[model samples]
Target chain A: MANDHILKRFDEELERLNATINEMGGLTEAQFAKALQAVRDRDTAIAEEVIADDARVDALDVVVQEQTVKMLALRQPMAVDLRVVLSSIKIAAALERIADYAKNTAKRSIVLAQGSAPPSAVAGIDRLGRLVRAALKDVLDAFADDDVAKARDVWDRDEEIDQVYTGLFRELLTYMMEDPRTITACTHLLFMAKNIERAGDHVTNIAELVSFRNTGQNFAEARRKGSGALYTTDTAP
Target chain B: MANDHILKRFDEELERLNATINEMGGLTEAQFAKALQAVRDRDTAIAEEVIADDARVDALDVVVQEQTVKMLALRQPMAVDLRVVLSSIKIAAALERIADYAKNTAKRSIVLAQGSAPPSAVAGIDRLGRLVRAALKDVLDAFADDDVAKARDVWDRDEEIDQVYTGLFRELLTYMMEDPRTITACTHLLFMAKNIERAGDHVTNIAELVSFRNTGQNFAEARRKGSGALYTTDTAP
Candidate 1:
């Protein structure tokens, strides 16, 4: 009877970890959304809110860490349980970083609001943000459902985000080259785009973690990098 | 007698892990240096070499992971051993990312070679890369010696890298504003500068990991973000 009670408690603790991860994942999704809205609408108030909410995400991350270490030391999970625990630890870290990136994008939004931001560039960011937000949601769903197939699908979609980002990067460079007046605003937009694209990468990482949790396989080689190399070409005189 | 033999074998395994981590660290430092020299000298050959060498770094990262998982499963380390193992996992991951950023910079260097890169901007990147490479070495030394003090000192030095990066960012903006022809070159330099700055952050993380291994503390709240916000101001008309 005592052994049964201990095993049940371990299950409960594992469930609790999952619940916390889901909670943190939801908040990062919200953070990314607000940050995107802040940039698209030039809403500094919303941007500040995204920045302010980062502390909460960080706190949850600490909870995840404490729980991970506690479980590892006390429960000493093995095999599948161990993999789940390890992957959750990584997923929590990725969520914290995603929140950080959201905060960075919000900061850029505030700065862009302070000046003249080009509508076209902001629109491009909006498109990229939409794609990333969707991917984040998908990855989170995969995590919650323990659905590796969905995670694989999310992983493949990262190439789409890369394509969009590369396209937007080229557009911004052309905007600067064609009209130097837009150079300053375009530069800020450039950073903002990079921030959003990087956020997409974190989301992709979460997807990979979800898959690793299930399969115990390393998917690093399968990733297709975005065309970031294309823009580095010598368009200079 | 049997326990003694098992314990000694565990020690040997731990030592091997440390040896591999140091090897990876040395490679990342060399990769960053070569990428820097490639950018500074506009040498495509050196850049190609950096790009080619990245696969070796990635393979080392895989080895680290395999060892980490094997140790956790077979040895089931505890207390100080657990902390050391966890810190090494993070440190190894950070080194891999630093190598990746170096590879990105090398790719940019190749592109910059095709165009007219501004000498001033290349000089700025060189300065930032030198600072980052030195810090990387110090963190590795601290790791090898298990010296928390040197690790903490390295953590404090990251602020200087931020300052250099922010100053370079502003200078690039001003150059782009004054001379339209240099905008393309300066833009690439800006990305390269960000890459170097990011590598510095990874180094700082390694420093913090070293301290964590010894003290069991998370020093994240103590970080001072550089003046990235300084350049994102209302400099636009």
Candidate 2:
């Protein structure tokens, strides 16, 4: 009876950790969405909100980290349980980075809003942000559901974000070259786009973590690097 | 007697892990130097070598991760020993990322060599790379010697790289605006500078990890973010 009670308590702690991760993941998703809206709608208020909310996400990440460490130290979970805690730490850290990137995109939104520049590339950035936000949502769903197939699908789709980013990078460079007046706004847009794309990468990393936690196998090699070399000749002058 | 033998074996495994980390760190330092030289001298061959040598660094990182996981699973180390293993994993991962950034800079060197672009911003990038490489070396040394003070100094110096990068960013943008012809080469140089600056951030992260492992304290907030906001009003045309 005592052993049963101890196991029940351990399960409760594990569930609590999962709940914290889910909360952090949900906030990160909102963070990315707000940053995107701020960029697309020229809503600096929303941007400010994204920036301010980052602290909450950051605090939750620390909470998750602390809880995971404590569980590892006290419970000494074996095998699958240990992997869950380990992957939770990785996921929390990745979420924190995603939040940071969102904050960066939001910061750029203020500068972008102030400029009376053409919105030629703004649509492109919005599209990129939407794709990333969707991917992040899917990855989090995969985590919550423990659906390996969903995670794999999310991993595969990261290449699509990369392709879009590279195309926009080229088009923006051309815009800057063709019209110097657009340089200031275009540069901010460039950074925002890169930030959003990087956020996609973190989502992909989280997807990989989910898969790693599910299967005791390291999928490091099998995870496709959708980045496709930023130094490609397409960006050359 | 058997317990004594097992305890000694555990210590030996930890020593082996440290040796692997040192080897990886040494290789990463060399990679950064080669990449820096490649950028400064337009040495494509050296840049190619840096790119090619990345595989070795990557393989070592995997080794470190596997060993850390194995140790954690089998030994269930407590307190300081646990922190050491955890920090080792974090440090190795950071080192691998730093090396990847170095490789990215080197890849840009090839395209840079093919162009007859003016050497206007290369000097700034070289300075930034030198500072980051030195910081990385110091952090690795601190890790090896358990020198908290040295790690703290390294952490304090990341702001210098960030300042230099921001200055170079402004200067390059000005050059691009003044002469649209420099846009291609300047863009590549800008990315390289950002990569080097980011590598410095990872070095600072390692420094914090060193401090945390020794003190069993989490110093997440104490690490000043030198990135200051990327949206600073400097690039406004």
Q: DockQ scores for all the models shown?
A: 0.31, 0.33
Q: What is the per-residue lDDT of model 2 for residues B1-237, given as tens digits with 9 covering 90 to 100?
A: 987887897899999999999999999999999999999999988998998898899999989977876787667787788889988988998999999999888888888988755686999898888899889989999999989999989988876777888888888888878887777787788778778888998998899999999997645654454235435532222
lDDT for position B153 in model 1: 86
> Per-residue lDDT for A91-169 in model 1, tens only?
9989998898888888878878877766888899999999999999999999999898898888888878878888888
DockQ of 2: 0.33
- Compose the digit string of candidate 2's lDDT tens values, residues A127-189: 989999999999999999998889989888888888898888888888889987777677777
Model 2 TM-score, 2 decimals: 0.88
TM-score of each: 0.88, 0.88
Isolated chain A TM-score, each model: 0.92, 0.93
Candidate 1 matches the true fold with a TM-score of 0.88
Q: Give the per-residue Cα lDDT of candidate 1 at B162.
A: 81
lDDT of each: 0.84, 0.84
Q: Model 2: clashing residue pairs?
A: none
